[model samples]
Target: MRRLRPVRGKERRKKPIHDGCFEIRNPARLLVVAPRVPCPVKSEHISDAVASVIGPDFTIAFQPIVDLELREVFAHEALVRGLHGEGAYEVLGKVQAHHRFAFHEACRVKSIEMASMLGMRSRLSLNVAPNDIAGPAECFHTAIRTAERVGFPVDRLMFELTEGEPVADLPALAATFRSFQRFGFTSAIDDFGAAYAGFELLAAFQPDVVKLDVSFVRDIHLSAVRFTIVKGFVAICDELRIQVIAEGVEAPEEVDVLRRLGVRLFQGFLFARPGTAVLPEVAWDAA
Candidate 1:
């Protein structure tokens, strides 16, 4: 495996967040100025100053998304970690409200740059907030530019819609999905059956993939209700031509239940944990 390059400047000064465009000072030079106005979905925005502060403080981690039927890795989801190997919660706690947009953008750029450096050939799935997709033009440009700069193929990228915040406009969000699809990038509704990513979201837009939340996967073999629910999801997704990925799976029993339920993709501890700067090896026999 190739070693990741060290982040430059161990100690850096923090810059105040700004509403308008500002200059970013980081090693990758991937961030650009923010728009003069705030994002339509949210009042706060991510400026260049925020990018400068958050960019270097974080690094990318890769967690394998296994394909059981194919018996190979389908994708490596890019998770954010601290520059010095801190947990995501610890690193994300430092981000203030104003830093949301810039932090999100920084994660995307960093993920692509690191994935390229690591010579990742599988799809790179990125977690995206509803607000980010609500205003897809800016985010799209940044992703396209970063992919070009790092020589990563655009078609291999996947955007997983996170449900941290509820999407107020389904029509607009659906339109955004179409915009991304036009560019050859696939989309996924993450944490299905939980939060705002329920059946309503599925009706609004049929993403290329749907990740069944841990709640649905946990103890599925023991609980008849869970089994029936997951089976229903798999059946529906199959009809819609949407791939189902059972995430947060941790037991062989769970895998047996999921496979019987027609789930071909799996992610969680049973496979491998997220490698801080490396791709963790998958335990193929576990499945």
Candidate 2:
């Protein structure tokens, strides 16, 4: 494991991009809100098993989310990486059905631990497979215990339902998200425009945040159709009062168009590349 430099400065809570937007940062130092608990997930043992089952080579990375208007970091999304800092696909491809659940649980614990070690004060976004956790109360409980063990507040966690994996049961997923919300955890529909149950999921369950898929954001400034679609999507989110973040943004032109269409939060190479075990600060440019 790579040792990270001690993060300097206190975490501070800033004004939110929109009312009801639950973005928070604490102006405090490394606070062991509580001593480590015996994580109910038994993540340690499971991680060892998972590594053996898959390949003993995997880790986590973080990519910063920027508040375009403020030109500051809003949150850091926890991503999976290979042991050698290879791409996510390389790490994720090693997962098999037999150990997928264990890998998922272990990833959760690792992300929390790494974030806490780095003194991350803002919300930590974690990805989850909706199908794997569709109906497990134990899964949720274990996650809560894991956070408590690391002193990471449940309120500062955002669970993103990835679009890559298609969910079989919408009702079950919605119920799970509701349960998380009840426990002070926020939900997000990631890869919004390109996923299964795209519009249907929105109608059934309104996530606190919606990340526009890369397909829509790619070369958007040059395409009137993409612009129109994104603009309409932004309008609907505004009415529904859901925050939107444009992901995979790589060009200045794309950022310009997205900002004009009421998008204030963005995540992509344009702001900062994903960092392994390190929190990369945002290099602001006029947006």
Candidate 3:
């Protein structure tokens, strides 16, 4: 099984929000910029030689996870962006197998630093690989310290595990999640329906949230088959007591169908594109 990779990246070149503190429409999610554009390259120690091997310069862009019934921002998923605003794969592609550990650590701490600097009050979600975090406490030393340094509570952070990486050892992965939970950090399974992550892992690990893949949510209103599948999936999650967040929701009709099927949480370009400095302004058509 290929190791699951880390993701969630973007950037903005804008003014600081009101003297280094800015408020989004949802006060819970704040985006603070310095007097000039703050550099996202907080991990200067990673070294240019090592970084050249890993790929281009790195930064972060945040995309909002929204709650429709409450009509407020629920959380921000931090994505990795290259200096030229390349996507996660572009940044990640440069990393070789041996450097993954360092790359993952760099991205995690960088996300925390930027989020904390921006005063993100909502839950901040960072992508992590099961392979990289099988021993959570030992692996999380940098993250924990960075959180404390930035005054961001561990509980306010959520680690996202994309299903793209299949787990080689279920028990070990579950233990890792347990370790993280013990430390007050939350967890979620990203791109849940897009891959082979299914009942076996769900029964074993039981993440706090399952992000429904965009394939399921895209044009859902147009497909009765999709509607039925997602509808049933929602029921299963309700019974299991796991929260479901629909991802890649781009149309108003998609939101309507998802709401009818009982998915309250959502993320997609319809609300806002991932932004570098501030939370993208949500149009609030669903509200």
C-alpha lDDT of candidate 3 relative to the true structure: 0.72
TM-score of each: 0.81, 0.81, 0.82
Whose lDDT is higher: candidate 1's or candidate 2's? 1
Candidate 1: count of backbone clashes, pairs at least 3 residues apart or interchain: 0
lDDT of every model, 2 decimals = 0.73, 0.71, 0.72
Q: Which stretches of candidate 3 lie over 4 Å from their true place?
A: 1-56
Residues 70-123, model 3: lDDT tens digits: 666677899998878899998888778898877887788778888776767677
Q: Sort every candidate by lDDT, greatest first.
A: 1, 3, 2
lDDT of 2: 0.71
In model 3, residue pairs whose N, Cα or C atoms come closer than 3 Å (at least 3 residues apart or on different chains), thus clashing, are: 4-165, 8-78, 8-79, 8-80, 9-79, 9-80, 10-61, 11-276, 12-276
Task: State how far residue 162 of model 2 sits from its true place (Å).
Answer: 0.4
Give a tens-digit lDDT track for model 2, residues 1-287: 11111235654444423322233343232212122222221225335555576554667778887776655566678898777777877777767777787777778777887777677766788888877774536546555556657777556677888887777888888887876665445678889978583898898888778889999999999999999999999999988878888999999999998988889889999888887646776757734
TM-score of 3: 0.82
What is the RMSD, in Å, between candidate 2 and the native fold over all Cα? 8.8
